[model samples]
Target: MRIVADTGRCVGAGQCVLTAPDIFDQDEDEGTVVLRTAQVSGDALERVRQAVHICPSQALSLCED
Candidate 1:
């Protein structure tokens, strides 16, 4: 699975970063969600899922393709 982030929809909540810092980060300027990497490892999927669910703006998703 891969992580997908829509920065335009982000509210700079930082929930993604808190849940999965290894895969998600915040842009320094705007503090919006930023993808550290789109590729998600098996072990990191759990954390990514939590991040997606907890995100206030719902800007993150998983792409199975």
Candidate 2:
């Protein structure tokens, strides 16, 4: 799976980071979503999906490739 982060739509709620710190982070200045990795697999896939679901701004999505 591939992570799609729309930083422009991010409100920086930090839910993504809180849910999956290994895959997501927040920009210190803008508080936007910063993706640590665009590709996801294994255990991290579920966490990333949870993060996407919890994102207040709907800035995160996963695409199966």
Candidate 3:
């Protein structure tokens, strides 16, 4: 699985960070989603999804490949 953040829509509210800090981070100066990894463990999928769901700007997307 891959986690992709649509930075164009990212407001960097840090919801993703709160959900999965290992997968997501914010560039405080830029207020953007910083993807820590394109690939993630199956165990982390649900948390990643939660982050995507909680993203106020709908900036996060998970792609299973």
Best by TM-score: 2
lDDT of each: 0.89, 0.92, 0.86
The reply for model 2, stretches above 4 Å from the true place, is none
Give the per-residue lDDT digits (tens) of candidate 2, residues 1-65.
99999998998899999999988888999989899999999999999999989989999999999
Worst 10 residues of 3 by lDDT: 35-44
Better of 2 and 3 by TM-score: 2
As a whole number from 0 to 100, the lDDT of residue 8 in candidate 3 is: 90
What is the per-residue lDDT of model 1 for residues 24-60, given as tens digits with 9 covering 90 to 100?
8889999998888998878899999999899888899
| Tens digit of per-residue lDDT, candidate 3, span 1-65 | 88888999998788998999898888878979898888987778889988888889998887878
